[model samples]
Target chain A: MCTTCGCGDGDTRIEGQGAEGWHRHADGTLHHHAQPGAHAHGATDPRRLRIEQDLLAANDAHAARNRARFAHDGIFALNLVSSPGSGKTTLLCRTIQALRGLLPVSVIEGDQQTRRDAERIRAAGAGALQVNTGKGCHLDAHMVSHAIAQLDPAPGSLLLIENVGNLVCPAAFDLGEAHKVVVLSITEGEDKPLKYPDMFAAADVMVLNKIDLAPHLSFDEAACIGYARRVNPQIRVLRTSATTGAGIDAWVDWLAAGARAAARSATQRAGPRGVVA
Target chain B: MHELSLAQSVIEIIENAAARDAFARVRKVWLEVGLLSCVEPDAMRASFEAVSRDTRAEGAVLELVAVPGRGRCPSCGTLSALAAREDACPSCGGYGLRPVAGTGLRVRELEVE
Candidate 1:
């Protein structure tokens, strides 16, 4: 019955499909109370109940479980979010290639169709899996959980979940990611952060992608970053051009630090092995 | 855009609560929706009506309570009312405004029989 949170079992239906309900008696006797709705004979009258429950509780619960799994394995999971044509794939390929000798990397590509992104990731010397969400707009925690199980990413490795290229819906679903990195391209204009404030605010890091084109375009880097900061004061900004290989080293360096921290956390959970101070 | 899916999840919550709490029908619902959340009330109501058909929450009077967003200025450490995501700090006129509330979507209460 998944008797955990309110959002249990399935989407549309209740857990118990048997037309009978369990009954309890005062004399310590148990019996089956037949009928689904007509339990009004035993039911109470109309009343208001305070149920402070999140609408996405089911998804959150799944995300919590996934978070626990990642923590156990010392995995630094990242959910890369952005609009279409934000150079997310190119940035991923660049990072994957750069991270080759440092750590083992696994990619979970989310899209409405095709395995092209997954292929690109695999070509960059990393294990990759493609999850086609069909008509689903965002990648929820349940879907990511399944992907992680299938990928079985190595302990203390990096799991980059490239979400479906949509700013709105992806912000509403948490996939148990350690960080949500939003990539915005120079061609997308500085007003993007203002236009899609929810996405910008939800992200922990904002990657200003395709920065090599800044000279040719009128994109205001300072203004763009300022707008992002307005919504998210703690968001860190990184400038990178996935094609020109500029700033990729800095991005990888930051990612390596995060991965190292994750590994240390895992080791600490297993009790400290003394060697150096 | 995801309102339809959100409505579907709401139905699931109602159905699960009904089964667990032994309630047959839900008469009313007080839904707490954050102002900063990118959800349209008209869209949510219309979608809820469609998804709640024949379910426990069918024909339920779904009311939305607008929860105001709050943002804090990083420079001056002043908190201000954030009506939307793009709202700047009223006190400092600074860019770094961190959100503290009004981003949650929850079902606050339900009238059941």
Candidate 2:
């Protein structure tokens, strides 16, 4: 029995199978355990240990490494977060199809089960990898690092990490993405931002998807944007409809600009290679 | 919701610290939870009990310190206590309130043997 959350301890696998690389422990160690009760510690005197550390320090360290790797490779990584059934995969499909030839785009799909989303991404003519988090609610930086190592995209490419569709947990766990793009469909309530402020505050861009059905539904666009702005004044809002291809151009433009900036920074950092010492 | 995972994370941190500090078992854990941290302390305690079984921290006392949320209002330049993230500034009633404190989730100290 797993000690945390009472969920059965299932090993996290990449691409729907056992991963050969070392699995990262929750404590950020890289060792395999023989069993839970196999080891025992010697009796010692009672004492206090002043461990003043952030619980997320290990995850944050992994995220820093992932961020550095992305910068070095010039990969503009965008983490897509939202509630389940918010059209994240549909948006990704549309994004991949639009930028297929113009730029090299790849996807890392995270979910509790199934390779269906990854398959859809592959059908869109972009390389895709699937990560089954098992009972985990959100993907952490270490998991993303493993996925990136397995699916090594070309330098100066776009890496779209479709996070496990969750608004709360993903906001707290940084996956080393350059920016977090939250997709909130109009079909959902406009008060979502106010209810889930942490997700909105952490997001750089809020994609108000399914706007094509706005005329049919009674969704309030202004109120939704207003609520989001209340939490995050600097958040960029984009109205989109994946079904009719509306507002896709704006999304693609934003992504292209991010990619250009990343590539430019990488070039500037390289600073005229081949200067032998 | 995610408190279970957070509880698991706490256990992992404590376990690692135990190994490094040569502690056989943990007697109590003092956790500092922020008011705006999105973690329910009761849920966290229940999760800790469930996830700490067969580990060094099993049956350990969970002492939580609730930290009040504080935000700085850009309009009035006043730091006030906030009940929620969407709360307006107490002085100016403005929306441009930046969070200043009480968002931390850390293991402040531990009593181990």
Say which candidate scores most in DockQ: 1
lDDT of 2 at A260: 87
lDDT of 1 at A127: 96
TM-scores of the candidates are 0.83, 0.86
Give the lDDT of residue A20 in candidate 1.
Answer: 17
Reference contact recovery of candidate 1: 0.61
The per-residue C-alpha lDDT of model 2 at residue B50 equals 92
Candidate 1: CAPRI quality band: acceptable
lDDT per residue (tens digit) for residues A1-277 in model 1: 2121222223232123111122323332222211223222223556878888899899999999999999999999999999999999999999999998999999999999999999999999999999998888889999999999999999999999999999899999999999999999999999898888889888999999999899999999999988898778788999999999999999999999999999888888877577432
Error of 1 at A203 (Å): 1.4
What is the C-alpha lDDT profile of model 1 across B3-104, one tens digit per residue? 888888888878778777888888777787776777776678888888899888887777666666687877899998776767667887786577787777
Report the C-alpha displacement of residue B48, candidate 2, in angstroms. 1.3
lDDT of 1 at A31: 22
Clashing pairs in 1: none
Q: After superposition, how far is residue A180 of candidate 1 from its true place, in Å?
A: 0.8
- Give the top-scoring candidate (TM-score): 2
Q: What are the Cα lDDT values of the candidates?
A: 0.82, 0.83
Give the TM-score of chain A, superposed on the true chain A, for all candidates in the order listed.
0.81, 0.82
